[model samples]
Target: MTTTLIIGGSSGIGLATARLLVARGDEVHIAGRSAQRLDDARLALGDAGTDVATHVVDALDAAAVASLAAKRAPVGRLVLTLSGSEGAGRLAELDLAALRRAFDGKFWAHLTVLHAALPHLAENASITLLGAITARASMPGTAGLAAVNAAVEALVAPLAAELAPVRVNGVSPGYVDTPWWGMVPDADRRAFFDGVASELPTRRIATADDVAEVVALVATNPNLTGTVIEADGGARLKAA
Candidate 1:
């Protein structure tokens, strides 16, 4: 059985991807900062009757990530879906702390995971990172996220080359129907999605599974590396 480690596999795209992998008979190890959320995810997986392990980890903590990696055997794939800040502010007005936290969580945390997991990643294994469409199609109030995500994509290219036999890629997803919408008011959220969905060439926002399928594809494709598969439903072109 293929052993895969999913960092930040508690909710949103991470949880959805975990469910898909478990269903496909992969031995999945999930790591998240919240013990309660991890327990809930295990329950939601509903006794998949497969080998599933949960570890409490804060991806920002390099030592903690290193410790967790030391405990695990070599893995066939590693997926990093850590969340970043959603701070809504102009560049001049943005909170430096919030911006720093965003980069720490998503950018630096991913690097830490790679550092710790490199030894445990088998040859020809895959490493998938999550990015956002905003990285390419920037918008107001999301400057920090766009900047960091763009940097992450840039980082992937060199890492993919350095990793050589191991495939390193990323999935840049557009708006998806996830709990993130809860951050906005109900009416505003509805209006926002309605507009976003219509603007996309596919006439819809992406789903968690949609993104996961791309990740799975990348994981299994031996020849693919330094690729950023956009699961954005043509949202980028529409935005452009």
Candidate 2:
């Protein structure tokens, strides 16, 4: 009977979490920017007769995001995994306009969704935000991402206090095998992942399912809040 709203839930960590939560007997509704992708994820997940809803949402539109929450009132768990790279490049070549757009996609999206859903959060509800190791494991060519992720982590403590029984926490994952990697050519991606793998304590990049385990843990734990569980395979330990 617990309903979870997963923004950006059509793929990667979001979709994997959807599957895991459903398997554990939770009704899930996935909102994504692409309807086709959402549908494909639903078919692949085969929600096991559990309620699995999908929506086409552009997180940049605050009104729409808020309206969705109003429509789906009483969300017991809210997980947001929305990610974008609008102005991703060296600071010297940065485009201010694109950077603003990127903020809307990531940081602003988090605020808007939570603001709209606050009224409907169930008792003892949990809110999980997907952060990145870039928040601390600063790598070159990731300045924008690092700033944005750090901003997200900055919200955990304050929001946790304000939200109270509705626990709010975050998870920062390292490189994972997800569609985000599909953007690279196979050979390059393999090489990159192999290079990262050798340095990783886990010796393997995380799968979406691997990160989902932590997301689920954060959602169900009653004693956790104002904290972030780093699921970055110890990448933060090595530094950038």
| Candidate that would win on lDDT | 2
> In candidate 1, residue 220 scores what lDDT?
71
RMSD of each: 1.6, 1.7
Output candidate 2 Cα RMSD. Answer: 1.7
Q: After superposition, how far is residue 76 of candidate 1 from its true place, in Å?
A: 1.3
| Whole-model lDDT per candidate | 0.83, 0.86
- Model 1 weakest lDDT span, ten residues long: 43-52
Tell me the tens digit of each residue's lDDT in model 1 across 1-240: 878899988878888888888888788899999999888878877876245789999887878877777676678889998876454478888987888878887888888888988887878789999988889975667788888788777777899999889899999998988776777888998899998888789998788888888888887788889999889998778767
